[model samples]
Target: MITQLPDDFRFSGPSMELCTLTVRVADLADRFRFTLVHWGDQLGPATAMLVKLESGRDAALTEFRYAIERHGMKGPVVEVEAQDVAAVGVAALVDDVLGALRLSREDTDWIAPAENKARALDLLHWWAQTSWDDMHPRSEQRE
Candidate 1:
């Protein structure tokens, strides 16, 4: 199980309108990791949350596709909205993705602290409610 982000994973570039979080796996055997990209602007009332499988993980990807299919969603990238995030919480989002991948927390290793996840959900809610004119971009100097 993963308890932290992989050492090689990193984030770069602007983050005001988008956040991409990823988990990576090093072996086969149907093991998988996920990439979640959330994006929004003041003009849009809802943030788009795109959930995908990490590249080169074919077994996991196939399983995820089937799972989403069973759930009535299209394959590979499942798009959700800010409202879903607000209602389910960030941990639930992770759980959903892991479940689709046929994985569980006991067998996966990912880092998502309660405080950080809550803060992310709060930010999503704030972005959903704020208008473009009233929105202030976060400082580029800060993470």
Candidate 2:
């Protein structure tokens, strides 16, 4: 299933825009496993983050781990679960990522601040752009 986020939906950061989310359920070990991809533009073309959620009744289970593949290398994975994560929190997390655009390790700068800041801003700028143009024609265009 594909879900298109609101067109006006956006935040500031250096990841990428919150594009459509694709969710697929597969039979893994006789149990259904959900594979959700947050598709959007990065440096070029588009990129995706592999999302996984641990099953639980508590809304906290909505917290998911994400991995981004850059140049065949997977970036660090982090846990991002918050109270505002509704039923479609996975999609919301995409916006959160785009808004913050900070990796798990980058939460703090123990090393060079200048270099890290530049990199973070670059990622955030690229991610902060809108993905409305990338959407299909059938998508609803809400002003």
For each candidate in turn, give its C-alpha RMSD to the true structure in angstroms.
Answer: 15.8, 13.6
44: Cα error in model 2, Å: 4.3
Per-residue lDDT tens digits for candidate 2, residues 12-45, read 2222222221121111111223233333343433
Off by over 4 Å in 2: 1-32, 44-72, 82-143
Query: For model 1, how many clashes?
Result: 4
Predicted model with the maximum TM-score: 1
Using lDDT as the measure, which candidate wins? 1
Predicted structure 1: lDDT = 0.36
Clashes of 2: 6
Residue 69 error for model 2, in Å? 6.4
TM-score of each: 0.33, 0.20
Tens-place lDDT digits, model 1, residues 1-143? 32223334332211121111232222222243333333335432221222233321111111233333355533232223444344555566556656554555554433344455455577666665664425655576335
